[model samples]
Target: MKKIKNKKIKLGISIGDLNGIGGEIALRTFEDERMLDFCTPIFFASAKTISFLLKHFDIDIKFQGIKTAAEALEGKVNIVNIFDDKAQIDFGVETKESGKYAIQSLKSAVKSLKMGEIDVLVTAPINKSNIQDDDFKFPGHTDYLNQELEGDSLMFMITESLKIGLLTDHVPVKDVAEKITVDLINKKYKTIYNTLLKDFGVEKPKIAFLGINPHVGDGGVIGQEDKEILIPTLEKIREKGDLAYGPYAADSFFGSGNYKNFDAIIAAYHDQGLIPFKTLSFGKGVNFTAGLDKIRTSPDHGTAFEIAGKGVADHNSFKEAVYTAISIFKKRKEFKKLTKDVLQKQKRRPASSRRGRFE
Candidate 1:
C-alpha cells in the first residue's frame, strides 16, 4: 500500500449514463460544501457531458478543468476531462454514442484508480445493457470491476444501521446453487471479517451467513446447500478464530433482527439479501464494493431513465454514496495507523513472549 500525508480523500468520479440522472446526481453531490471539506471531488467525464447534465437539470453550479487534485479551487468544482473525442451529450436520449461514452468514463476512472490518482471512487448508475462492446462483458459495475481486479469482490447494500452482502449478484437462480461452494463461502467470510475489523474498527466483528434454500434446508429436506456447503465453511472459519456464525433460515433472518445482531450479513444470492435490505433502506442505501484494492462506492439504485430531465430523481442514495466513500477512506486511514502502532509495539516485545503472550 502506498502511504502519503493525511489529507482529504480525493474522489475519482465515473459519470454513468449521461442521458439519465447520473450526471445530475454527481453534480449535486459535488456542489455540497461539506463534501469538499472531506475530499476533493474530481469528475472523470468530459466537459461536454458535464455541461449537458447541468443544463438538463438546470443546476447553476459552475465547474472547470483542473490539471491535478491540488489545482481544484475552493468554490468551483474540479473536473478531469478524460475523453479526447466528443459526442452529442443529449439528455433523455439513449444511443450507442452515449453508451460508449459511459463505458469510456468508467474505464478512465478505473485507470486513474490503478495509477493512484484518487483515493476512492464513487460511480453513478449505468445501464448494463447499454454498454455494447465485443469484449465488454459482465452485467454490472461490481462484476466488471471485480474481474478487472482479478479477485473476489463482495457487493454490499449498505446503510449505517444494517448491511447485506450477496454471495451471488447478477446470476440466474439455477446457477446460484452451482456457484455456492465451501471455498467461495470461506473466501467471502474472510473478506467480510477483514473489512469489518479494518474498515469499521470492530475488534471482533460478528458476521452471520444465511442459507441458500428455504428454511435453511430444514436439515436437507429442502436443499443440501446449507448442510453440505455453508455449514462446513462456517465451521472451518470458526475454528480458525474468525467471529462468524449461522446457517440461519432465510425466512426469519431479516424480520427477526438477526441482521442487527451482527456487523454484516452474507446471503446465498442477490435477491435473498437485497429484498429485505432494500425494503429497509431503498432510496437511502449505498452500494459498496468490498475486497477491491481501491475503495469504491455507488448509489444502489439505477439511472431512472424515465425520469431524466424532469428534476424529479431523488438524490439521497447518491449523497449517501459520496459520504460513504469519504467515511470509508477515513476509516481505512485509521485502520492503517492502528495496524502500524500495533506492529511497532509488537517489535518492542521479546519475540518468544510476543508469540505466546496473547493480547
Candidate 2:
C-alpha cells in the first residue's frame, strides 16, 4: 500500500455564540474522518467550552491547544484556545460572558486572517445584538467586515448558482427608499459582476435588479424608484458592456423563476431579497461577504438558539458553507491565473493582431 499525501485547505473559524448552535454545529461538522482530505479547520474558541461540547454531544474528537498557528497539524483537529475561564456558560442562556467570548473569537479569527495565517474563513452564525456592545455599533458580519477592512462591502446569498444581494441591510422599511443611491447601487453591481466573472468564471455575467415598489411602480403609479434609481443603474451597467438587466417587480420576478435567468439578482432591500432567497435556499445558502479583502463565508441560517443542546439542529448549511468557501477559493484562484495568462499573451501579441481578434 502506498502512503498518500494530505493536501488540505487551512480554515479559520470563529465560534459564533457558545450558548447557541455555533459550538454544536462546529463540533458536528468536523466529526467526520473524511474531512481530513478537504480542509484543516482551525476553530478559535476556549478549550473548556469545546471540551464541554464534545462531551455533551458525545462527539469523538480532541481539541488540542495550539500555541501558534504554525504548529497546527495537517490531518488532525487543532484548536487555538482563548482560555476564557471566567464564564460559566449555560446551554441556552445568552449572557454577557457568551457575548464577550464570541467577540474575542471573532477578533482573533479576523487578526489571523489579516496576518495571512489562514487561507480562507468559514464562520458560524453570531448573534449580532448580543456579541457586539455599545462601542461596537455595526449591525452584522458585513458591517463588521466593512469596519474591520476600512472599506465598503455587501452581503450576497449563494445557493449554488442563484445569487441575491441586498441593497439595504438592517434598515427599517421607511428608510429603504432613502438608502437607494446611484453610487451605492453601482458599487454593489460592480461587486456582483466582478464576483461572477472573477470568482465563478462566468465570461459575461447576467444580473437582474429587483424593484422596491410593487409591480415596479407601474411607471410611477406606486413609486418612482424603479424608473429613477434601478432602471438607470441597469442601463449604465449595460452601457459598460455587461449583460445586466431588469427593474422587475419583486413578485413576478420570483414567480417565473426569473431569478434563474441571471447569474445574480440585486434586491433593493434586505427582506426583499433574503426572504424569498432563504425560502428557496434555506439550509443551503452560503452568506458571502462580497468586496472583502479575503474570502469570508457563513451558513445562511442562524445559531438555532431554541435547539441549542438538543442535538437536532441540522449541519447542512454549515457543511455547505465550508464546501462553498473551498470551491470559491479554488475557482477564484484559477480565474486569476487564467486572466494573468490571457493578459500576458495579449501583451506579447502585435497591436494590429490583437485589434484584428477584437474586430
Candidate 3:
C-alpha cells in the first residue's frame, strides 16, 4: 500500500502516563531509523521525560528536541517539550504528577493539531483514573477528542480482519441500556458508515449490530431492547440506502464466523464490543477515534504499569496505531479528492444536458 501521505506526513505523539509504558513503547517504536521514511514524528513531551526513559531503558537512540512543529526534521524523531522541571517520571506507578504531565502533553499536541502543524496523532496510553482533573473531566481520550474537536466520535477498534465500533464507551453497565436511544444509535451508525467509506476506503460498507440482551432478548423474555429499539433503528438505517444488518447475539455472531461477511460491527456497549475485539486482536489492535475532524489513534492496551520500565512492553499495537493513523490520513485525502472531482464534473455538465434529479 502507498504511504498514507506522499509528502512526509507529520505525526504528533502524546505521552500518556509518564509513570507507565507510554514513553517506553513510544521510544521503542522509533528505535529503527527506517520509521522516518514514511512520516515525521513529533513527540509532545519533555526532554527530561524522554532522556529519563532512554537512560532507564539504556536505549541509544537520539531525538531532535524542538520548540514547535515547524522545526521537526525529516528522517528524525522530534520532541516538542510540553513540560520542563515540573515534569517527573515514576516508572511502575500512577501518580497525580504523571497524570498532569500526560494532560500537558496532550494539550500541546492538540494545539499543534489545530494549527494544522501535524497530519495525524498517535497517543500513548493514559491512566483514566489519574488523568481526571478539572481540565479533563471526561472518561478517557475519546471523550476529550470529541469535546475538543466538536465531533460525535466513535470508539472504532481496528485490526487486520475486523472493525468494531462502540455505542457507549466507558459507561457503567447499569447505565448502558438507558443510553441506547434511537438518535444515538442512528448517529453512531452514520458516523461509522461514513468513516468506513471515507477513512477506510470501504465502498458500500456492511454494518452489523449486536443485540443488547442475551439471545437477542430471547423474543422479549430476556429484554425488550433488541426487539423494541435496535431492530427499528437498523430498519431506518437500511431505508436510507445503506446496507446494515443484525441485532444478532454477540457470542454467536463472532463464533459462527458471521462477522467476516461484514465491514464493521456496532456493539451496544463498551465491554460488549471491546471484550471480543481484545480477545481476537489483543496485542495488535489499534483504537481509532473516528468521526473527528482530525485523525487520532492509540494502542488498544492501557498503561501496563506492571511492565513500565522493563523494556519488554509489546510495541505491536502502538506500532499498528501509527500505521493506521497514516493510512486513514491518506485515505481521507484521497476521498476528498474524489469527491471534489465528482462535484466538479457535475458542475461542468451543461444544464439542459443534465438529467432530472431522480433520473
The candidate that achieves the highest lDDT relative to the unseen native structure = 3
Ordered from best to worst TM-score, the candidate numbers read 3, 2, 1
Worst 10 residues of 2 by lDDT: 350-359
What is the Cα-based lDDT of residue 205 in candidate 1? 80
Candidate 2 lDDT score relative to the true structure: 0.81
| RMSD after Cα superposition, model 1 | 3.5
Expressed as tens digits, the lDDT of each residue in 1-359 for candidate 1 is 89985566678888888788888888877666666777778888877767767776777777878665445555457787777766576667777777777888888788778777777888888877878678677788998889776457999888998988888888999999999887788678777777777666778888888888998899999988888888887888888776787888888888877788888899889999989988988989999998877888999888788887788888889989988988887788898898788889999888887642111
Once fitted onto the true fold, the runs of candidate 1 whose alpha carbons sit more than 4 angstroms away are 1-6, 67-75, 89-94, 353-359
Give residue 186's lDDT in candidate 1 (0 to 100).
69
What is the lDDT for 124 in model 2?
85
Candidates by lDDT, descending order: 3, 2, 1
Model 2 root mean square deviation, Cα atoms: 3.0
Model 2: per-residue lDDT, tens digit, 180-246? Answer: 8998888888788778776777777888888879988889899988788878878887886777787
What residue pairs clash in candidate 3, if any at all?
none
After superposing candidate 3, which stretches have Cα over 4 Å from the reference?
1-6, 349-359
